[model samples]
Target chain A: MRFPRWLLSDRTGLVLLAVLMIIGIGVPALNLLVPPDHPLHLTAYTVTLLGKYLCYALLAVSIDLVWGYMGILSLGHAAFFTLGGYCFGMYMMRQIGTRGVYGDPVLPDFMVFLNWKDLPWYWHSFDMFWFAALMVMVVPGLLAFIFGWFAFRSRVSGVYLSIITQALTYALMLAFFRNEMGFGGNNGLTDFKDILGYSIHADETRIVLFVLSALALAGGYLACRWLVSTRMGRVLVAIRDSEDRTRFLGYRVEQVKTLVFTFSAMLAGVAGALYVPQVGIINPGEFAPLNSIEAVIWVAVGGRGTLVGAVVGAVLVNYSKSWLTAALPEVWLFALGGLFVAVTLLLPYGLIGLLRRRRETAS
Target chain B: MSELIFEPEAAGMHTPVAPVDATHGILLYLEGVTVSFDGFKAIDNLSLYIGDGELRCIIGPNGAGKTTMMDIITGKTKPDAGRVFFGQTIDLLKLDEPAIARIGIGRKFQKPTVIEPLTVLENLELAMSGAKRLRGLMTTRMSGEERDRISAVLDQVGLNEQAQRLAGVLAHGQKQWLEIGMLLMQEPRLLLVDEPVAGMTPAEMERTAELLKSLAGNHSVVVVEHDMGFVRSIADQVTVLHQGRVLAEGRLDELQVDPLVIEVYLGGEDAHH
Candidate 1:
């Protein structure tokens, strides 16, 4: 089949594909083929870092889809990501089976330690990988659907909507922190062993996980590209500019907002799921509202409305974050805080907007 | 054939089955419509009607409820109590803003409201007859016919040469015309235009008067305006509103002679000073 013009003609899409190809193939090759002593060898630490960035990129893109294009700034997206991680983490815990320190075939160690009698009914289908995978998308998507149905229907928007989202993530963080919630509390779920029968710590497994994360990020970007290019995307842009005007034009503002909002949550959930397997743990701390706010900063720093900007911002910001925490840890938060204020006051369109202007002048 | 604005014949774009509601003499009917915000009645027991294909100019002083009246007809505002009907069958009071638009009622805002980031042509395509639904839009392709429709509207609005330009970059008058052209893309049965000449130059106002007048027979046009000169230039029938109720209804020449309409305008001016 001939290549679709949208994928080929779009400079941003092409850039995304090139970047994904290098990471998807190149990193895995380095990890598997290079000798440990070789300075060029891709360290497991680096692979895991890149893999985590891909997950964050997916989350940032999802946030941009709503916040930038649809004008729905969701500061609670971390809740969905945490929910997804917990969903997959539950499966990870279940996979321990007889190998768990307690040697219990069915009950996870937390339940046995807590002296719970039998497995919770909610945990019934979580043992299967496919079920857990489905939950990773469904749990977040469902929560967003219900939340958006009420919020959008009532016409809550702007900073009030943003505040509500922050409240939601904070509340979830508190809920997940409770010991009786069945989900591992405080310390949360960890000590994961096998995943689909492969040792979780195996180098080959890590490489595969890294590869899958890159692929997920690529797929997420493409799906978003297709959505934003369509007529529905035009409706989103219209709603963003003048919501009441779009409504009077016969577009149901609530339905449009709901669709995009729910879809974004699911994408963030998938991102979170990938993140957990690569990072090797899931905890209530992931649900903190601050994490979602940081994700928003990434999108803002990259460029809000530009899809490629979101991906670039996510990867770049996290890379900075990792380096900063190790280098000048005392100044990381202040630097990030200052970056958001600077972007808001100066760049407005983020880094991508600056790049576009430079290219225009050059051309 | 509203969908004819696109490649209906060539691109095989899905043709929308426009629900044609038979009118019984009146194209739009409103009776005893009332709306209040914080006990201040914006529209107070308003009753109005437009005959089929009628060009009715609604003139009133500020706070005249002209905009609120249009809002009721277009389902943007729900009256505390009233009857609003499109043609004979559709009860507008029961429907939402989008459902009313789907039934072929289109409205232009007081301020020019065009989708800014989108190109002028894209703004028209979005409001074009087809691709209104999410499913249709998802699988839709821009057909040759759709291009012609956009070109036609662009020419009509005198923006044919600027079709590729972003709507946000258009001059103020051009943005108003772009919005009108966007409305025209709907091929609406009834058009509610609010203050179309608000920000236009005198020459632009004249062109807008001509443009609005030409649209009367094909679509029932209800234009709310404060420009008496522009109203006199195009109105076939005039409805004067005062304090959310009908002050007078007649030809512009006839209403100019009415004591109540004169008193309301004189009173409005007195308060301004």
Candidate 2:
């Protein structure tokens, strides 16, 4: 396939690969090879923190694939991310196997506490890491396909689609928070012991997960780049610019939309799965509508349509979020709001666009 | 000067048809097409016919349902009651917009709706005749001959000079030409062009008239135009629409001098104007 060559030929794509490579190698070295007492030593907390950031970057790239390229503003993307997290959380719960606080081979602590005699049928096969991994991608991908089928076929678009997506995630949030839903309710599946019998607390495992997150980000970027450069990509942009015109041109606009929407959801699921292992928790809080809104800001701050810009935006905004929440605490959301307003007014294309402008002027 | 009449045999040499409509010799047949928006009948019991490889012009005042008629034929608007057939075999009313378009029916919007961000060449590439299925586009690349075809269309439209420019930045006349060029890419059996010269300079209008006239013998062209001079220049037969029905259908000279058409459209006081 010409897909690899197609991506490497672009300057933005090459720069993305180089940056990911640096982060992938440098972070692991700093965390493992360097002495722990050294001032520049990367701590285990920092590794997990950056791992989580990489996962967030992957999520942002997925959003940019649809929103920037196809003009689909999905406000409920966090639902897919959380569902993927929950899928893997189920696996982690199954892996606990008699080591839980309840010490039941067949049930996790939540099931035991709920007085269930046997593992719920839905929870079966999660004990195998491979099946759980498959579900991580499959579950979210299926939901997005079904949602897009109903929405696009009904000709629902623009702000109405966004509103419906928000309602969907909100509904899922309520459903998952109930004690009877069989998920952990308020405190979701957490305290995961080991994955594939590898210690979750090990620094080596953290490094591997961090590097894997970085790889996923790079892979996601390449895939999106390849997709947009193809004729299929041109059709997608045509749909975004003039949907009726596209339809009249003989392209099935709804099918095009559903395919991309489903693909993007799968990418988010993979990101979420990686996230659970690093954060050591999966909870209903991840389904919060505010989280999805915050993701849009990341794409906006970085650049909406450009895949690389989405990654840049996610890292920069989240870093600011972490720093502000530590220092001023209550000022983060306002800062995010202010940043969005400033980006909209001044740099409508985000930081990547800003760089391109500077380069154009300089040249 | 001697009068010249186009012999029917000369017209079919460059004809493009998926399957020749030899039996009917009629490219499009519509009967009793009625559509209403919010209880205001935009198209009321409309019936029309277009012959194979014929260049027909439809002229009407604003709100006379010229566009609505085109919409019904192209399946953009589903008539409450109507029968629409293409080439005597295809049931047009049963198909959707894209399906109708795919089966060799192309319609140009009143406003130029090119993908603004894409280059003029890219716009033509998207409109070019080929596999429109997602799988086909994903697996295929444009062949060398396809590039040559795009170049030919650009030259024909006099847009060769601006082929590299963004469609968004094209001037009003240029955008209109580009849209026409786009429609030509599909090689549709029946081309529905709405207000082709609405915003054109006179020079552009002349070129557009020439372009439409040249396309007639190979492709059946239906022009919904307000410019009488353009219609008179290219129209083999002119159909006058008034209040969602055909007011008159004949040669331009016949319709221009009709007493009833004059009373409704061309005024008695402004007869010579």
Candidate 3:
């Protein structure tokens, strides 16, 4: 009845994480060390791409917290991420002021050109970085809490909950796309100068953002681990496996699922907040339903239940995406779809599942 | 061993250890408890009174409302109309399931519902973790004393040897024992078990009966079961239900001689009666 020590232990995951960290940080430093005129400078592009992948990794981990452990397959997580991005995007736009192309100190160039007179009421506090950061976590967390409170309390679950979540994201996407909404219409927000007084375009700033992304990923994973490690964690798993039994065991299954779902959405919001500044833009495109579905695929590809599998899957899939888009642009979507199908059909447990099986057999 | 067995308190601190001599009258009074699903009344104004430390068995045909009655008592289903009292003090109707469970009423469904992915030990540890919303339960792991209590209950349910096993891999009967062990860990004064012997082998059935019988002196148990033989072996009193109402109530031998009880069992032309 004794399982292998490594099967249950997080040591293997921790080791794999350490190796990935070394590569993520070391590769960027290695590229910078090369002579500026050398051909090796081309590899620096990988740093931005990898940084983006790390942000996606954080998003995947967030999705896994709800879907894998709590049995809430939210198709609206992109809404939270996009909402966070928009919050940060507002702050970034405010930093432009007179530096924008139109040279209008009070209004953004897009607004000045569009002939809007005053800022919208909701755009009041983007001047403060702290408020923007708070909104990034709180907005999504609040939305998820309200939605989940209604859905879960009404006993909505399984495929029904999934469909409703999809509808929610679609609705937000439509709302954000409107020209009158004052969120820069379809062009969205861009043209940032500084974040907390640091020149965002500088190499040192990129390194700082990259390190911040890594730290966020690590912190998110630990927070999730701490949650699932407790008695409440056991209750969530029990709920996922058999909700009726959990209820009979005197658990408020609805409350547990709602709390976890809100927490998960908040994490995804943080991911989106960090993503906007590093990439230098936030658009209506961030609200795409496909993006949320893609997050699900990342969790599925890595191994849904394993926390580290999420990070691995996100990085691996995006890396392949970047490579494919560069090498064969038209075929990238097909390849992505094919990877999803192949993983679903042949390996339901995904890549980490295969690794665990092989280790078990070898042992 | 004999001394420990004589001292019921030695069973565990959580175990119900009442004095031998007392009035020991009805502790739970379920009067006019009625529940309806859609239009049909699942429990039809059913009334039953259970005494303290009484090993009462409820026997019925399918759809006789045995599960519904247990549901009403445990706060799983609300009764549209009824009064359910615990020890002349607490009204069970006003409490939610978790609240009712905290007040020393534990329930076991027909299926063995242990936390299968967890170890048998963790399953018992979780039973002692208290209500789910209670935040501090997780920060504190089970103390050594709590562990000893869990082991004591496991020994009682004959699962001590497999304490570290994944509950998923256990034999069918062992899973049932593990669930019972979970209830025992909670140390509830009253246990409501549904179909404890169904799908069990004869040996397992015998052991389960023995376990329930041994629990009778300290704990009051209400078992809703279909198997008459199992009921005869362990039940101190048996209540027969036909449709949603009680058909007969007495010792098993007395119920066997009652013509109404016989008619309910064989499904006669006089079934409505």
Error of 1 at B107 (Å): 0.7
lDDT of 3 by residue, B1-273 (tens): 323312323312122223222254777889988888999988898899888889999988888998888888888789999899887767889876755666677888899888788889878776773334344334435567877898789889998889999999999999998888877766677889989988999999999999999988678899988777888899879998878888889999988878878777734543321
Candidate 1 RMSD computed on C-alpha atoms after optimal superposition onto the true structure: 4.1
Docking class of 1: acceptable
Tens-place lDDT digits, model 1, residues B66-151: 87887788777889988988878778898878777767888999999999999998899888876765566774368888888888
DockQ of 1: 0.42
Error of 3 at B101 (Å): 2.1
Top candidate on DockQ is 1
Cα TM-score per model: 0.95, 0.95, 0.90
List each candidate's DockQ score: 0.42, 0.32, 0.23
Ranking by DockQ: 1, 2, 3
lDDT of 2 by residue, A132-166 (tens): 99999999998998898789878899999999999
CAPRI docking class of candidate 2: acceptable
Interface root-mean-square deviation of model 2 in angstroms is 12.5
lDDT of 1 at A73: 93
